[model samples]
Target: MSTNNYPFQLGQDQSRRKFIYNFTKAAGVATLLTSPVISHADSFFVPPAPVTVGEVMDMFINQVPGAPFNSTVDTLKAGNRDIQVTGIVTTMFATIEVIRKSIALGANFIIAHEPTFYNHQDQTAWLANDEVYRYKADLLQQHNIAVWRNHDYIHSINPDGVRMGLLKQLGWQSYYNPVATNVLMLPTTSLSSLIDHLKQKLFIDKVRYIGDLKQNCQKILLMPGAAGGTRQIQAMGKEKPDVLICGEIQEWETAEYVRDAQAKGQKLSLIVLGHIASEEPGSEFMANWLKEKLPGMKITHLLSNNSLSFL
Candidate 1:
């Protein structure tokens, strides 16, 4: 890719403000107001306004207009209510570490990008009798923490909150193609050089690779979190990108397909940035977003420890 070929141009200060304004307006109040409610026994417990979980969720969906909520394992945790949520914390997953962080920050409500429970759907029915699950559940109950998931919602949101956050962190805001978030035309650089740059820029340690690093390709397709199905595969074939930057892949599916493609002499390479690494930036963006939405509420973002180790 030519240096001149980089598609985005950073806007001036005024332009950036306008961009933020437009982006927020486009996102709408629904995404901004989808916070958890709180209840208190004392006069101090009363919020300025009472809001329900469903109502906040609806608002979030409306604002984003494209978040995916159907596959969400559970919408609201077992015990949650509509009161004024005092503070909010956005996290990739509500692990033991995350819960502790939320409490330390004085955040009572958690908006998770992934599942609170282990599974994608976050079903705990089978774990009812399981000791480990019981222990985790009991901890939340003791803490008075309310958890709501925003998996599909963030994915479906326009510009994709996660992807947007990653791009912003990389200072690649102007490089996005006007046509789509996945398609980005960046300045000319070798694959290895780009990888090194990403490591430092993203501050990550577990980036996996599938394909030759020596290959030079300008147009890159970034499918963060996880790569999709056969249709997406076919589309990638058509695009014939130099590289596909993704969060993670199923070894039997996307990884296998990429291997086959390489054997067939395709020049494409797949860079597997860990799922959490790929999605964490978006969580950071969510913190900023929540701060804007609930100005009075304290918001913080917590990152998951990277899951991969190189031998």
Candidate 2:
């Protein structure tokens, strides 16, 4: 049979007939041949567009309760937005070790809570001739990794995502009130016991504290990150918590304030958890949230540990 010379397209007709026959036989119903499955067979094989960096960012920004802010530090610090994201890594900071780990894990996008560079704004112009900056920047370029700062957006969320994550990690959610996000009313425990608990929970060796070891602590002023000494002192003044659990503090500010208060017979204390240890939970929370939003996509939380060694 000269099929090529036929006026009617014989191959398409045979394919259609064969498809219907198979579909009917598999479905066990002859009437199912008229179903939309036959018409959609072509489209069923078409894969979805690969998720781009910009698309993921858009989805994230859109989901944030009151996002699309007029001004934000949450900008792409490295790499372009058009590239497709193979995987995501969330961390407290995109240190060189973390960046290398991300590369090893086959991740192309990094959502870091803090700046990648040594500055808050991540300005790289001044570091154009610096060796350390060049090395880090070259590593990112070689791996085609994109680093995006998520500081402002995460902090802007209701109840503060970082604080919520810390509460969850420390099992203090029961005592947390959204209205008073900075306060946690916990069972009465000694200051030393609380420090031990924090060290265990946050996976740290030691923490700098300024209170009598046996002093009882029930109310906690939860300031995870560096909220500045003035803010910390002011919050303590207003909330009057038994202990202030904060990240980092200047030598002369909050510490001196607590010292003066102690001299005056006021029951005040402070525990420094370090910046990374305190906010790492928030990045972990981000990883979990991303998994829900991007089903089937690989998302990991990398611990950006402090480089300083403790005796």
Among these predictions, the greatest lDDT belongs to 2
Model 1, C-alpha of 49: deviation from truth (Å)? 7.6
Segments in model 1 whose C-alpha atoms lie over 4 Å from true places? 1-59, 66-74, 229-232
**TM-scores of all candidate predictions against the true structure:** 0.78, 0.84
Taking the tens digit of each residue's C-alpha lDDT, what string does model 1 give over 111-174? 8888777887788898889887888788777877788887777767777788898898667788
Each prediction's whole-model lDDT (CA): 0.68, 0.80
**What C-alpha lDDT, on a 0 to 100 scale, does residue 261 get in candidate 1?**
87
Clashes of each: 7, 0
